[model samples]
Target: MADIDLQIACEAPALPDAAFVERCCSAALDKIGRDGALAVRICEPDEIRQLNRDFRNKDKSTNVLSFPFELPEHIPDELKLELSELGDIVICAAVVADEARAQQKNLNAHWAHMLVHGCLHLCGYDHIDDNEAEQMEALEVQILADLNFANPYETL
Candidate 1:
């Protein structure tokens, strides 16, 4: 199951439908061997920029932001599985579209990449260091390939 709910807070006439987004998220979850739920919100750049500033302190909008589910400290790891919520992914449609055009990537493919990347982030995969980045990118490439998308990190 895709197990993802999509919310559109901005005009999304050009965005992919929920089914496609679910497929991308599902592929990423399956690659990482997890069964959970996620909330994906498509928002305007202004809202995203505010969120980036408030949460990440970046003060700029980005393509995607992942908020992983945080369990209470008292919750046992074994019992935490009962929650099975992967948290949320927020995508800025304008930023993503601009990035796709600037990076010379297929718009849909770039969307898929962002969804997959967000799913991985929800699963605790990050690219903070070179080794971690390589590992994450390799996994992303493999998952995207499984979904028939080309390598996203390669320059066009």
Candidate 2:
């Protein structure tokens, strides 16, 4: 594991809890365990939509996106390089708020969920398949539980 440089910037309508942001980032880095650097940016919907189209060729804003450092898969562990410089996470605050309301959850908890999900992506985790989804969601539940949030997947 190499040193991880984590940078989190929030550019949205309202500022979030500074301590919560730090905790979330720290938890991510802890999970990443110094494999690489990470930059997490919380943005507005329009800004995220533009990024979604520009990078992913998608026209709508999504909750999160992860871009890993350009690297080869066969690299040795010590020589593996810092892929975690992992890239950025663009979250739409309005979308998060709306989702929270729709799901009948605390806004902060939803924010934490998205942040954790994005961080997991930064650390090379994904949910593109069923098995992967289970693993990733399990980890998310454990992490969020540590933060005193309820199991995110529980049915209301």
By TM-score, the best candidate is 1
Give the TM-score of each candidate. Answer: 0.95, 0.78
Write one digit per residue (lDDT tens) for candidate 2, span 64-128.
66665656777777765433456666677878888888889988888888877887887778999
Regions of candidate 1 where Cα sits further than 4 Å from its true position? 76-78
Candidate number achieving the greatest lDDT relative to the actual structure: 1
The global Cα lDDT (0 to 1) of model 1 is 0.92
Compared with the true structure, what per-residue lDDT tens digits does model 1 show for residues 1-156? 658899999985589798899899999998888868899999999999998999999988888999998988999888986788999999999999998889999999999999999999999999999999999999999999999999998875
Would you list the C-alpha lDDT of every candidate in the order shown?
0.92, 0.72
Worst 10 residues of 1 by lDDT: 11-20
Candidate 2 accuracy as TM-score:
0.78
Model 2 off-target regions past 4 Å? 1-14, 32-36, 71-84
